[model samples]
Target: MDDEILIVDDEHETACHVREGWKVLIVDDEPEVHRITKMTLAQFIFDARPIEFLHAYTGDEAIAIMANESDIALILLDVVMETDNAGLNVVKHVRDVLQNPHVRIVLRTGQPGQAPEDDVVANYDINDYKDKTELTSQKLRTLIRASLRSYRDIRTLEHHRRGLEKVIAASKGIFEKQALKQFAEGTLEQLSALLALEESSLYTLRHNAYELRNSTLETLLSNTVLLVGDDKANPSDVVLEAMRQRQNLYRDNELVIFCNNPRHSLIFHIEGTRPLSQMDTYLLNLFTENIIIALENIRLNELLADNQREIIYRIGEIVETRSKESGLHVKRVALYCELFAKLLGLSDEKAELLKRASPLHDIGKIGIPDAVLHKPGKLDADEWEIMKTHAQIGYDMLSGSDIELFQVASQIALNHHEKWDGSGYPQGLRERNIPLEGRITALVDVFDALGSDRCYKRAWPLDKILTLIREEKGRHFDPDLVDLMLANLEHFLAIRDTYRDEFQGE
Candidate 1:
């Protein structure tokens, strides 16, 4: 039957280029069958695409080809090859061993008795079974078109499923990101996952929309091109031209996405060897839209946080001024707390939290009467005992709030005066019993208080303050924190100099 087939004209067979086409693998032991099949489909075009035929004469050869090529859309398998069950074995290998459920397989058999149609369809994972005699030129074309359609639809669904999974995974902790650069980098990582591109891409953020210089874009272009070694010093003329016209560019293998707001303009540059499909472009657009909204929310939340910090500091300042201490005391303590938290190996988020919360440590002093708070002479035992109530009072004022910063501040207020050896303050928390935030704020507050002038005492010399701190370690302060402060004494001194009070003299 195969010998009865006529060869296609050379002019028709070699006319069109097979650069872009659905990959079709033909597996049959008979060389004549392979040649006749190619000739019959020489002029066939499905969905505006030509067929790129890969010939594999045996089941083993077909397995090798499938192993190497991932984009094979359809396999035309002959049931009787080297062995009667060769085609059936290949089906098992592709579906079970390779775990490739996307590629469609159609079994063509010269002898239907060897592998019954109903039994093969019911027992194996083959998509369709056909007799060789019934597969004429027209039947072959129809069969291929149906198989390719199924394969294309399956691949499209699989691609979208994978892209959605990546989007969900990448967006996990993005909303909690406090810094713009961190959020931007994380957004880029998610973009990479969405597009299946490499993570090493250049991102440019232009604060001034009017200052879109070619130099900035050129730097990004150079970095991206260099990463892929694309041999171009500048971006493609299309990309440059698109930027000049203020339009987005999506090439087969490159993408330039722009996001703009009143305050900032964000540009993403990604390049790869394969062009993005329409689905990829759609997913990227959706991801970027969500990113813009997320970024706006993050910025607003950051602004709110800044305002809250300022309010807390101002309230602390009012308390300090009433107690005859400089407002700079709170500011310096905040900076010192941040530094100590970092030195103690806390994460950036936790360090910033401590910075914002430490300034309220003396807020309890608001409850102390003016006579004791403003007394110039040494406080008598009664006045001292009355003054100690401020810690409990401050904690009472700020506690019971669901806000995380306030909760932290309440802890600092309650325990900052407590001694490490159970000898100080309202609670007398000893050693590790004190909250870590309290332990940190206690050391910074005392350091700044000793160095700055107050109503009761003149500013002590740096050497005298250090001697006192060293002598009192493990008795008044956490021993490890005291050692850490001493080790990084120069940094603390820098913070003191940076936030010096205008009223240094008593």
Candidate 2:
């Protein structure tokens, strides 16, 4: 309502009388125009704000003044100032060049013939055309009111359009579940700008406590935001209910919870004595709807990942069942892989993934015929070849998977039999060429094989098993990893003891 209006006329007393409760800008060829517009509008108050009269003597002066204060809602333009078409040119500047669309322009000319109504209306952007002589005081007031109302509506629409754009832009960043924090921060920034309120005065309704978002507002308001809670020790049930009900309660300055994270969310408070507006409610709901959906998607994605891990564990158990090996052998190997991954300096996430994936290193054995897998003696050539097919079988089972863990597991299953010296099966990938995961699993698998009694072979003594690993060195094992196994031989022995086959006594 404090937004200004402009009046342009040659008569000083008349201009002053017209400039009442509105802030006014006067533009005319005669200096007296400024004085009258101000005097006429002095007594009238539109919305609690008295008219501020800004004076301009000619068309050129009016354009310059308008450029500086483009927010002027209404402009009473004089047509016969300096040139007959001068007012028309100013209208063009305001609409086309300056691009100030919200201000309402009314054309007023002393000489009707010099700038005819028909011609001016057709060519110019002015809202209304009038002759100065026809303007009575009551008629002038009516014109001012109409122009101001149009200006107000236009401004409101503009503010709204900009706010929606901000919301849409912020929503784009909410593609992933974890990105809720980023989206909330962006939504808050745009909302604060659109509402024309101090950012601190805005409070978002979240779980329990309304947390202070803006740094400046947090200190200024002393962290006392809207609270529906019982006591200030922590957020209470009443406070939670108030937020869930979308009720705005301003009793004392206690923070409110607004934006929630995966578990806890961020709450920001807008500090001001003025109550929340309809626009405030509208914007807050818009942001909340977007954030809630984003958080939900994140949780859903995590659940799916966990389900996938469980499936892989089950698949590994199936492979173990194919041989005389205990199902827990797969689980024990998975744990050993994790320990080895950590010793090899893998990140926690990568180590965990390897732990889940490494158990499937023998997954192809599920495809091998039971006669060859559960054979009571060393395999003949044909049976050995059939046994070797397990590697390819395992590879085929896990290949072409979109999942990263399964993809790596497939490669390990295909190549774990290959020796470090390039003398092993399937592809015979040597030393450094072998997938590191396959290499690590090979060591663990062999150690487990030799330390435990298999249906085809007796469990060797720990000393003898260590000597076999030492003998294999670069020829059968990656020497560096071989050293690691030697150092952790007791740990490997312990795993064998822990998940030892129950049927070994038979």
TM values, all candidates? 0.79, 0.62
- Taken over the whole model, the C-alpha lDDT of each candidate is 0.79, 0.68
Worst 10 residues of 1 by lDDT: 204-213
Predicted structure 2: lDDT: 0.68
lDDT of 2 by residue, 271-349 (tens): 3334555555565567567755665666566577678777877887787877767677777778777878888899777
Q: Candidate 1: misplaced stretches above 4 Å?
A: 2-4, 9-23, 27-31, 38-71, 79-99, 111-129, 138-142, 197-248, 251-253, 262-264, 455-457, 504-506
Q: How does candidate 1 score on lDDT?
A: 0.79
Best by TM-score: 1
Task: Write model 1 residue lDDT over 1-506, tens digit each, in one string.
Answer: 64434634223223343547888999999898888888887776766678899999899999999999878999999988888898899999998989889889999988999999999999999899998988766667778888988998898888788777766676665565557657666665566666663222224321111113233555544343222222333455655655555556687767765665544445556666566778778777767666667767776777888999999899989998898778889999999999999999999889989999888988888889899998878999999999999999889988989999989999999999988999988877799999999888888888998898665567889999999998889999999999999999999999998888655454
